[model samples]
Structures are given as structure tokens and as C-alpha cells.
Target: MKAGDRIRTVLLAGGSGTRLWPLSRRHCPKQFIRLLDETLFQQAYRRARLHSSPDEIVIVTGSAYEFLVKNQIEELGEEVLHDQVLLEPCGRNTLPAIAWGMRRFADDPDHPVVVYPTDHLIGDGMAPVVLQSVPLAEECLVTFGVVPDRPHTGYGYIKPGDALQNGYRVAAFHEKPDSASAEQHIRDGALWNAGIFLMTPRLFFEECQKYAPEIAEASLPGEYSLLPSISVDYGLLERSGRVAVVPLTVPWSDLGTFAALHDASRQDQFNNVGDAHLFDTSGCTFIHPEGKRVAAVGVSDLVVIDTDDALLVCSSGATERVREVVEELDALHDPTVLEHRLVYRPWGSYLVLEESRFFKIKRITVKPGASLSLQQHHHRSEHWVVVSGCANVWIDGETRLLPQGESTFVRAGAVHRLENRGQIPLEMIEVQIGEYLAEDDIVRFDDRYGR
Candidate 1:
């Protein structure tokens, strides 16, 4: 691809993915979940990099997922340019995110843009299809239309007109259809709208201004509004006339639900899927907690998800309604539905082992050579017990090295820091007692991970 013709890739990564609930919570969403060897967002990044340079790739994610996105991208061992990660204070869905990304690239008139959702699984060679469609993006807004393998009612359908040189013009766009209509659509050569879009930034904004003036006006404030909580398809794609579809015969799965995940994943002879330990089980999807075992017995077509603090058991077919359950829990202000037991930090992770009204127990893991910020708590005192590796602990003005099985105390309002000077991962158990045990009680003096 020519540098002048190169298309900048925008990854929309802000969804909470409530459908994959229990395993995918609000704090640590589905994009960060490891499907194969890497997370879904990482796969999207890698795929984007296959067609565009690192500098040309941009990620738009929620403020809460900013650290998770940064850490995952950084772990790829590439120098990620600053500001490439745009943080949204909250999610306003794809249109606002795409609008923000378009505004960022609108500075360069020559650069085309491709907007893709992060939590999709696509074939390896689909990058060339995106690259090939960039030249024609000026005439028509291009979307990848996956050839329907089955009559999938969960996906939108695209009716194709006469074939162009590289693809076909989209005659009509259909929302998720009923089973009979979906089957008829498959028979009538309707393609699955894969949510893969390619267009020039100028063209995109112009079309938004022309057709979706509300969204265009929303973009003018330079920030997304909380109102109009709708998706891009309902707001733009259904109303736009200048749209084209490129048929791709690739092995792809959205993996948006447990049934889809099970269908996309490999299964053993007993038809059990995932890395979880399955015993005496047939046709089960058991997703285990990381570094833990999830053993099932005499189960079939069951979806068992094991997290540190919560466990979910449901039929695979009922997974699509999991978000409703999560929503009900959220309505009740349930913390388990909001945050996972293991919270990912930029430096490492901390898992909650136990908690009470006045005390909390946590298992903290610091990566090699990583350190926590020099900070003080207002209402809490902590007792740190080194579990596996060496820990360089700083309390008030005193600094000491604590090996495995050693312990230290940090009083409330006293400055403290923890570091892993050793080559191995630092594991420690932290017990806190206080009037308040919330995460916002910390006052940071210095942070290496940019907090």
C-alpha cells in the first residue's frame, strides 16, 4: 500500500459485552478476554497491523478499560505511540467512537480510514480484502459481508445488487431477522453484515453530516453525549444509500455468546470445549478461571463459567439473555456484576481473596521489575505477607526487602510502596483493615505506570 493511499485503522473497543457475562464483567470486558492465545482486542490489533503500520492504528476504548488496552498492546513488544489510545469517559456506542477517530484522522486529507469492532474473530487473510477495498472507498462506503454459512438470526443481513469490479453494491440492509426470514435471506444470497467498515475520513464525516446530522452535530462538541444511546447500524447504515458490500468467504465467528464461543472453539471427543478440566462430561462448555480447574460431571449442553468471585451455570442456548441478568443485578447496584474479583492494573493484577465490613484480603501479583506507586491511604492500614517471590517494601521512611513468608505493616496515612526487584513474579497477600476499604482511598505520590 502506498503511504498516500494508506488507510488508518480505528478499533472500536468500548463495549461492556454483557452477553458473555460472569466471565466478562463491566470492569474487565470481553475484549480483554483471551479467546485463543491472545485477547480479542489484541487479535484485532494484530489484524489491523497486518494491513496498516503501527502509527496508522488507533484504539478508542472506555476510560475504565484504558489501562487494560495499553497494557495488552504494550505486551506485544512494539513501541506504541502516545495518543494512539483515545480514552472515552464512557461508552456512547460505535458512532461516537468512529466519529472521534474520524476527527483525529481528518487532519490528513489523504489518509483513508477503516473502522472495525475489536471483539470479532476473522480469518488470517482478510487483511488483503480490506486493503483491496480502500481504493474504491471514495465512491462508496464499504462493509465486509461475510458469506453466510448458516441462517444465523443473530446477525444483520445485507442484500447485494449487481457485482462491481471488486465487490457488490449493497441493495438493502436488514436488521436481525426472524428464523424463517433469516433462512430465506440465506437462500436469497444475503450476506452477514460483519461490522467491518472502510471509508475516507472526510467521506465518513460528510455522510454523517448529510444523513445522520444528529450524530454529526454530536461530534462538533468534540465529546460524545450521553443521549442517543444507539448503535451505528440503526443510526447510519440503514439510512445511507452510498454503501457497498464486499463478500468474504472467511471462517469467522463473532463469539458474542457462549453458544457462539462453543461453536467457534475446538472440542474434544466428548464435545467438551475450553482449557478447563472436564470430568465425566459430554457436550459441555466449561470456561475455567485462570490458573484454576473447572471440573464438571454428567453435564451436556451446559455452559459453566468460573470466575474468582462468581460462578455461572446456564444452558448454552440461553447465553444471549445473560446480559439481562447482569442488567438486573446492576439495577440492584451489585458490585459482583460490576467488577471482577481479579482487577487488572497497568503494572500487574490483584485478586480479592476475602472481604468484610472492616477488613479485606487480597492476593497481589507484581510483574518482574514492576512497582506500585508511592502512596498513602486515608482510612486503611495494610499487612503485606510475601507469598512466592522477593518484595521490596517501603513503609513511611523505612525500606526493606521481604522474602517469601516475610511480612510488613503499613499504618493509615503512612506512605508505602511495593516493588519486585527479583527476576520472578512477586506474589503477596495483602490484608487491610479500615473504616473504609474502597479503592479510592489511596493518594499517589509517584507512579511508574502512569496511573
Candidate 2:
């Protein structure tokens, strides 16, 4: 490693958060949702940018979320090149994701890479700890360890061994423990595994090859699907000898459950932390995402998360088991288990307003200068009524401009497209009559986004 070498940041954002269900789903995870003023991805992006240049940052995400990744980075007013984003064909877990990014930095293996989970939150005190990891990255695989304020059973614990120059050697790695075990670990002065890793590309890839050969051998995107799904901790750090833990002097939370979210968010006098209209509700967190008026009558120590299609009501302590609810929903083939009513796209977003056996209604928003794919639906005919802005509609090679209140009909099997040519967003109501109303029914002729 040289003094002039600059370190880059890699964001591992492919995990599907199951604990934060109803609000988080398979298609849209917690990192992408607008939790506070901006999404956690935005927050993580800003934090990562603090240490690396925009061009130096790499985002490893699932293939389905390629556009969401780009859109979020675009919202930050920074350009994300196509090569800057690594799209996984399917999730093979963190080890593969980090190794894929490390492949890109193979030319300069000594160049440091700071890895962060895009869904986590870190305080300003993390700045010094992160800066300290830069030099430590040259010598060892560094993982930031947070001192446990409480016996948090949700996080993995790190046992510190021999003392290092700036940190400590890893004595052992513990999985999420029971109440008694967690308390014991705290008594032993264990650190919470923060999952933030800083190491050089050569060190990471070498560690992966040594310990996680199955993941390290797969270089192609298609081959990654065949690799076993394993976390970095299980595959490398826990098994490798070249590991060190630096204490993080900052407030941090994985925000993996509703209880953690509640603890992180500011609460009212009643200890509520969401946008629900409470009625005699105290010590309850009501997360009504659709702005539906939720009346919690005399509830305490409860979590009520309401989406347009699903409602989750559980005890505060039971938030960890919410994944079981998602499992049951998946077993029942519930589409609501995967996405919200309002679905996001690269061009913009669309909200499913109504649906029936043969028809579906949607409110679509097209961003300025953005256009939908030039495609034809096999089983659906669509009627679009413009609500705001201007739309340049193309049907069967014929173009027609539609202003607000104007409508257009797209016949079944017609090659049609919708574009927003105006300076503002184009809002339209779409009513579809179809035999099969699904996203996979479209056959695209051309797409600017290379979908």
C-alpha cells in the first residue's frame, strides 16, 4: 500500500429485510423505502461519499433493483455509471457480493475498500472510527465492532482476543443468542458485529479464496447463482486468521426490526413513532404507510404496521418473528406479500388503485424526459387518461400528444409507449381490461434503459 492510494466504498444492498415486513418486501426492501426524509440508501450513499469519490463508489445489488439503485443515486444529484453498479442475477449473499466488487479492483489490490450495509444507520462519531480503519485496512481484514449498550439478541457478537496497534484480534464470533447467552456475552465485554468491513481488494479476495473457495471461484454472473448462499462472517472473517475488530465510537442500529426502528425514531408523549391516528394508544408504534387512519384502542407494547394490502399486528418482543408471517403469506401465494400497492419503476412509479377478475386500474407517474418501454401486451388492452402534464403517446408507430384530461386507448397486441415530454411529471390513470394482468405479459421492442 502506498500513501497516494485512495480508498473506495462498496455498498452491500441485496438483503431482503423480512423482519420489517408490510413496509419492506421482496421487491422493495427497507433500504429503498422513504423512511424519514430520504431512504436509507440515500443516507448510506451520502455517508460513503464522505470517504470516497462518486466514481469510486460501487453498489452491489440484485438485478431487479438495478434501476432503483440508479434512481436513488440520481436523486442524490451524482452520476452513477453503468459499470459502477454490479447487478447480481440472484442473491448469493454478502461474500459473493463483496468478492464481485473486489474483482473490479483487481488491478490495484492494495487500494482499500470500505464496505457498508446500505440499510444500516451510523452516527457522526463513526467518522473517526472509519478514518482509523483506512490504515488498518492495509494490514488486516477490519470489521467495526460496536460496544453493546444492551444485550441485543438481534446482532451478532464479537469476542475480542489479543490487543492490536489500533484494534483487537477476534477471539470468537457468536450468532444471535438467547436472552441468557446475550447477557453473558455482554458480561464478557463482547462487541456487536456492525458488518462494516474495510480491507484491501487483495486481502479480501485472498481471504475469500482461502476460506470461501466456492464463492471466490465463481467469477461470472450466471455462475454466482450456483454458489451457496453464505454471509461474509460465516465464509471468511470467522474462519480467517487475518481479522481484526475496531471499536466503533458511534450510535448504531441495524434497524432490522420494528422494535429497533422504534428505538431509533423519536417518539411522542405516548411513545408512538409513526403516522397513524392514535386513539387511546400508548406504548404502541403504529406504522400506517398508506396514511390510512389507524385507531389503536388501548394498545401497549405493540407494533401495528399497515400497508394498503396487508396489516401486521404483533407484540413488541415478537417483531423478530414477523418473517414467519411473510413465510405463511408466501405459502398462500399472496401477491401482497411481495410488493406495496404503489410499485416503483425506473422511469417513475405506478399505483394499483383497483383490480378485478378481468380488469385492473392504476395511477401512473412518468418523470420528465422519461419514457416507458416500446412494448405490446399479449393479454391486456389499456385505456390511459392523462391527469397532469403532457404525454407523447406512441401506438403502432403513430404518435399522438395528449394533454391533461385527454385520453388514449391502446388496443390489445398494439405496440405502444408513453413518454413525458414536458418539464414536469406526467400523471395518468390507466384502466386495463385483460385475460391475464401481470407484469410479465409485455414484449418489449425497444427500451432506453436496456431492460
Task: Please list the Cα RMSD from the true structure of every candidate, rounded to 1 decimal place.
Answer: 2.7, 1.8
Candidate 1 lDDT over residue span 264-317, tens digit each: 889999888977666778788878766775566677889888777777889877
- The top-ranked prediction according to lDDT is 2
Per-model TM-score versus the true fold:
0.91, 0.96
lDDT of 2 by residue, 110-190 (tens): 888888898987777665567766777888899999999988888899998898868988999999999899999999879
RMSD of 1: 2.7
Counted clashes in each candidate structure: 0, 0
lDDT of each: 0.84, 0.87
Clashes of 1: 0
TM-score of 1: 0.91
Residue ranges of candidate 2 with Cα displaced over 4 Å = 1-6, 276-280
